[model samples]
Target: MLPQHDRRNSREVFIGNVPMGGNNPVRLQTMTKTDTRDVQATLKQCRQALDAGADYIRISVPDVASVKAFEKIKNKLAGDGYRSPLIADIHYRHDLAIMMAGIADKLRINPANFGWPPESKKKQAKKSGKSEIPPGLLAETLAPLAEACKKHGTAIRLGGNAGSVEHTNTLTKTRSAEFLVNQAVKYLDILEELGFYDLVVSLKNSNPAETTEATRLMHQRMQQTGQHYPLHIGVTESGLGVSGRVSSALGIIPLLREGIADTIRVSLTEEPEKEIHFAQKLLDVCRQNGDNVFEATCRDNMLYIISRTSDPDTLIAEAVQGFLTLPERNAIQHITIEAPGMANQQVVKETAAQIMQQADIKEVGTRFISCPACARTSTDMEKLCRLFRKELADYPGIHIAIMGCMVNGPGEMAGADYGVIATSNDKVNVYAEGVCIKRNICGKEAISLIREILIEDDSGR
Candidate 1:
């Protein structure tokens, strides 16, 4: 049995009829990848996620059309007898977020872009050398959204991404855990000043270590400010397949064990239902009572993870749970998995290495960062990501990103050494060290080009 720990005492906040935090079970959420304008398709994906045990479903509301479509999708779900809460994922436009506040059960707005000045005003501010938003102007911009949310009884999530923080606040000009926390807290403070207390917070980074660190700091900062709003924890752009799962586990499990996360989403580069399923498995391993299904032992700086079940997913979850919750994780220099009934020791070893690598304790192979392709994506992102992974398997220590679209791709994958972002169904922008080196190249040709870049880089080294 794992040692018992107390959950952070967050105040209960309701999303539609569902309550999160304050002794509520850790909630699971997933977002629809379908276009919001495709009401039927979006509704279908929402139903799939709900059926898979998600407590909340988020749909991207990228533009005015999507906002209208989201309203239709919400009504359709209601007409079909589904009562699960729907969250509107809004970016770039505070007006869209304000519009969503009246319609969605929850509005997820990025703090980096939520109340920032428009480009014209931004240029003016730059000329005047004003780095911070004046208090009155900030209130003027956000007050309407706050009032709208309050009128509709909708909760707001001030989600900060490490990838985009540099674009907004001068205080967050350098992207670090402390800077991320500072940016989020500034927004939270303004929201509180506006008398909007129904809030959830999230700080995500593509790097698992940064995500973990930033969230931990956010929790502490909230406590200091006497803000007990629930936390929604996730690692953005966790990629696809086992790499995605391991990365999610590494970033999330430790926080879950520490009792910091009130709700969680595992952002995988696949169908929404897959994310829900993976979250279920992850939650099972990190239940609040601290009664894990696996046993762990450590000797001579080597930790051995043992499980009775032969199921690979369960074993991986157990290993993650066992490794992350250790009191002296840094003291353990190695990990060995013992699943005698399982025939493939190689799988076990690989799983262990992945866990270690994702935790930032070791670097076993190449790192992949990918986003859950949303309606904004133009290409077959899942297929492309798999192909890239298969082709780039031998480049250990290199970080590559397979982003679905240009919207958040370049920013979210800022840490990747090399990356590709789809500009259209057939064309992509290739990136090296966060700078776009090639634009609008054929998607098929991008793979070879990246390989050549990698080979050239290696040879130069």
Candidate 2:
């Protein structure tokens, strides 16, 4: 288990020599508002942001010409003895990403635009469903980009912005959160499959409330799936002046309290330097208010163990005992066991339960149980688990189980306080405190039923 700042234990990612997420201080990042093709102006803005304590400087790379400008900017910055990590913000031109792979320390790819063919053909794709590229094809298209980043040791940000893309017709506050989560998860899966794990995830919306909710949902999903990608959060098109600052702060601060954000940008419609100052202020508030925010939520005894071995369960149990022996053990907060193999949700849950019985470790508010998902999984187990976590984020003293398929699903879920078991034909059976309360509920209706049950349980109705 690595050291955590608040409740989150994000995987650490490096941009140039600077580390973001996990144990590192929440970083402040700002983008150069100047045209990236204007090397001198871009250089000036980057320098301004750098001087203002911007941890990472982003420049929009729209074409090959911009790639050349980026090279000049990178060279000039390094020649002047400034090693600030430079990010190439590529919206529709992933070719630029491949071109500047080694040139930039990080590449920002918007999920909404990267898959669509070059800017000119984007209109053609937008006319139909071509814009929504299939996951496998999307992954194939991004493989070269991933390879280039891997070759250069650069990180990728799967940037999801509400302003850049239209929402599905079914979009609501809740559905919008799901939409963002699905976009992020789909892109992240593609990146992971391509063996590019040096990544950050962000879900940005112009609306402050939606921005906050989407980021929270993304965090919960990543946690439930055991993906430790760092998050870069902000409110997109956050306008200017007091309103922009207020909206951005409103969106970012709450997540910061929950230890959900890793790096943040204020995205003010003002000077790039202003963004740096505003972001720093937001981060300061997050730090100042952290103690009060996390006083009740922080669990000092929880430990998340990460290892690559055949037997993660035994290793996790041993870690708990070893963690207890340390003099500074009391300082530990939460632990997440991340072993490459044999680290499924059932194993993690059973191990945690066994450890709790042996140790006096207090349980957290919500407990999630889900299958790791295989060919036999009849339902989207990962999505269900994440949605449960999101809905149950504030609910305490509830154990929720999400299982796919019937093999070990029943037995595994029987241990949970409440369970949603996926049977054949895409139907779910809901259990309450280990008792089957409803059977043969299908589709989204199952989720609604589970929510009602939990709400009733929480309200003691």
Candidate 3:
């Protein structure tokens, strides 16, 4: 449960059967980049993400064919015992939303981009009856989507944007707040008429003022209607790399801190997984108390806030079975050393550098010892050393000294609570406090033995 000082409240709503909101952990979602019409590839990607800890999956059902794909994906996921909610991104066609909402857990409807023309333009579109969408007919068309989704037990996402309404492209920045609110006003009435209340609202824009101002107005109007709804907030299409993270963050932080957004997706052109990572960070930043702003790790060129940036390395060290940086250095937190002949010493070195540079720390994870890999390490020394380092990836807190042979391995690792050494091609030694407590046969088996030691030390197992 969140403490009183935290701004966001717990509002648990089940996606498929997975509960999100209110005292539960934040749910992570990712959209399948696959073409939705391809059933085999799309579901495969969805399941892959599901296996990778994605809590929910969203797919773009742009056309009728996409709905067919959705059905196929839904069935497969259900068969696999996957309960994460599936969200449908509907644009330019409410019919797609109507057709697929039965299988989908959520239907996203962007009012700004409702699939219709303005009253005047819509009349022309009707007269022509070609492929153009009209504005005034937006509500009439989407009414079916809302109705179908509700009857089928799917929730709705009524999306609003500050830059421009999504579907019609008719409303510009000059549009009044009253006009925007009126658009949603009509939408809510239609939704209410359909007897649908399982809905969330999203009011996002590149411009924060318009986003927030319109949100405030619409929220007040919803109050007038005596109905409460969840809101998903984001700053859409805000550049890329660090710039995107900052702009979206600045725009989103205000709304979240005020307890406005119930769900968030920081839209980015980067990989879909990258989007999920940043979304977690922003949510964390908003939930944090006092002035704990920099409590994030700057990893993979993305920033993630968990508490204080200062504590990230230490926590990672504990979580991963690697050593935390032993010394503090102002803005920097930890450091680890790597040397050769230790084949995976590179792993320790690279991880430490990334932990400091990307994870926003001052130092490293483990120390590496190298007598240098000569012409003779080809058989088992290199293989055993590499496996040893990789297996300890989860032991986050303790320092392990990787040394050259058993000569320096015994003494150089004196301060380390744990160490691994290659005794020869067929033998290895595990040392604790200068004593070889575990004897090893070569190959990957040595790594497994070392991991058992870490588990016992860390988990008291």
Best by TM-score: 1
Q: Which of the numbered candidates is closest to the native, going by highest lDDT?
A: 1
lDDT of 2 at 147: 92
Off by over 4 Å in 3: 1-14, 19-27, 39-41, 44-53, 115-140, 166-178, 289-461
Q: Of the candidates numbered 1 and 3, which has the greater TM-score value?
A: 1
Per-residue lDDT over 1-461 for candidate 3, one digit per residue giving the tens place of the 0 to 100 score = 12334434533555567655545554666677566777786777677767756677778776777788788888888888886789987755655666877888887767655656435655677577543334346556666676677678788777765434432223223355666667666676667776776767766544344566777676677666665665566665433343345445555555666665656666553445666666666555455543333333443333332322333322222212122211222244444332222334444344445445323343233322222221112233334444555565444445555443442244335545566666665666777656677776664565676667766766874
Question: How big is the positional error of residue 214 in model 3, measured in Å on the Cα after superposition?
Answer: 3.2
The TM-score of predicted model 3 comes to: 0.56
Residue 288, model 2: Cα distance from true site in angstroms = 1.9
lDDT of 3: 0.55
- Model 1 per-residue lDDT tens digits across residues 44-87: 99999999999999999889999999999988889999989999
Per-residue lDDT tens digits for candidate 2, residues 1-461, read 11263648889998889998878888889887665777897899889989999989888777788888889999999999999899988756667788888899999887766765555555554566543665656776788998999999999998876534422221222226778789889888878888889999998765566888889888889889999889998876544433345446657766776788889887754567878876765665445422111111224655655534344323342333333334554455555555455646555554444334222244544545344333234465545655666666444456566766554355445445777877777678887756778898874676687777767766996
Candidate 3, position 299, lDDT: 36
Higher-lDDT candidate among 1 and 2? 1
Pairs in steric clash, model 2: 302-335, 303-335, 304-335, 304-336
